[model samples]
Target: MESFADLSHFLRSHRLRTAPAETGVSTGAGPRTAPCLLPAELARAAGLDADRYADIEDGRAGRVSLSVLHALASALHLDADDRAELFRLGASPGTSRLRGLGHLTRAVPMLPVIAFNHRYDITGWNLPGQALLAWDLDWPVEHVQPNLARMLFLGRATRALYGNGNAHGQRQVAGLVGALRRAVEQHPDEELTRLVVELAAGSREFAELWARPAEERSDEDDCGVLFRFEHPAVGLMELSRVVLEEGAQNGEWAVVFSPEPGSASAAALDDLLARVSGRPC
Candidate 1:
């Protein structure tokens, strides 16, 4: 409710920013000549009844569905960042989770940090994470954030990064599926369901993993799985993977990779950091 309080203001501001021509709504002649679209015009564009839209815009709607939020975002012509913020503002109670993603990455300098919610949607990564993972920081903000399971099962770069190829990748995905199973059972989230459905449809490996019994899955090493990456920039590197839970109830966690001190992997990581920071190693 604390965050939801801002939803009205957010919607109003965006609606004000929306041009009449953008949504194809003509500015009526009764002194409404400002570039902004009227509430009724926005409601028509968003396909909601005028009263319903007014309730939502007035903070009187107790809970708005994701579908409605998506509609509003599309009608407003919001870009990715604004869309993300719209969802955050419209999120139902008990769904508010995680510190600011960028802040979390900045909290730990020189370390590669990848954080996600219960749904495993990649929220943010720091410089080291971008350098090590070859994540294109230059990508347009509208680009969808990478999902972990999707990366493991469908991404060529991620597959190539796995030192042992498919075998290692499958193991990693099995671990992810195992965690997802727990999250799905506990939360019954819509985004998580969509992710599972998408991956199962796209990747045979993910479908097979998801089909297996929980007892038969081998995700016991999820806490600290040892990963070896054949990084294009740094060659072979070994790091211990640690999952740090950010919020106990939110199912948010940060994946951190740390190398043993005085090892080749450590040197490789240092070089990566230097490259990212523009400092000589």
Candidate 2:
């Protein structure tokens, strides 16, 4: 796996790799080659002070405004996707009332659903959903919030639970990092920041993937995915997952898994559901 550096390191590295000529800065006559701009020079081009710009990369300057972020993007010559990612990093995780709720779960007819916020915090899981994943929901264990990323990386039974464990684990980790890296950059002050910081410091896998550039991670436009769960009791369960975002923009998403029609996996799922529910009340 390729290990990646944080935004600060990434920005610094890109800046070094870019030539002065590319940004329309002139290099003094040397037969050798044109050089990259120093931090000071680049900052000047961005119309920002060197210290403030450094703070932007490090995420120290709180709540970077749109104008300033755009200026930096323009100065860095970031493309459309890069600009979108940069914007996500700069945006705030709008105030959400996710933590205080007694239960974060939601009910959808004839489907197994789990709810989570943009930060990947697993808020709720339907009984069928729980039967599929088979993990306890005890959260904020000594201040560490229970989220999907933690389970995938730290849980003992997590890998065994997945039919395609190793590959899926890596893919999930990568996707989680891609989602989270932007969040940390966005609201490095909120409760979720604690989760991100702790995971980054504690989990090497999480850290390495989080450092990967956005383009290297999963596509943000992907509507859903296909997953297979190797449940201990049920054997195998395959389903297509679609993330249904609540209209409120509160960052909550309902993850629903739909079993395929006339598939063995679907039959197994039906049997498992019946065994668990025992003739629905």
| Candidate number achieving the greatest lDDT relative to the actual structure | 1
lDDT of 2 by residue, 1-281 (tens): 01112345556776887777667754446663436767766787788998998776665765666567657667777642344344444542331223312132322434566656667665445556655654333211111223676776566566556534368646655666776776666545467777777777887777777677785545432455777677767776777887666522665555678788899888888777776664221
Candidate 1 accuracy as lDDT: 0.71
Q: What does candidate 1 score on TM?
A: 0.60
Each prediction's whole-model lDDT (CA): 0.71, 0.59
Residue 261, model 2: Cα distance from true site in angstroms: 1.1
**Candidate 1 pairs with clashing backbones:** none
Best by TM-score: 1
In candidate 1, position 48 carries an lDDT of: 94
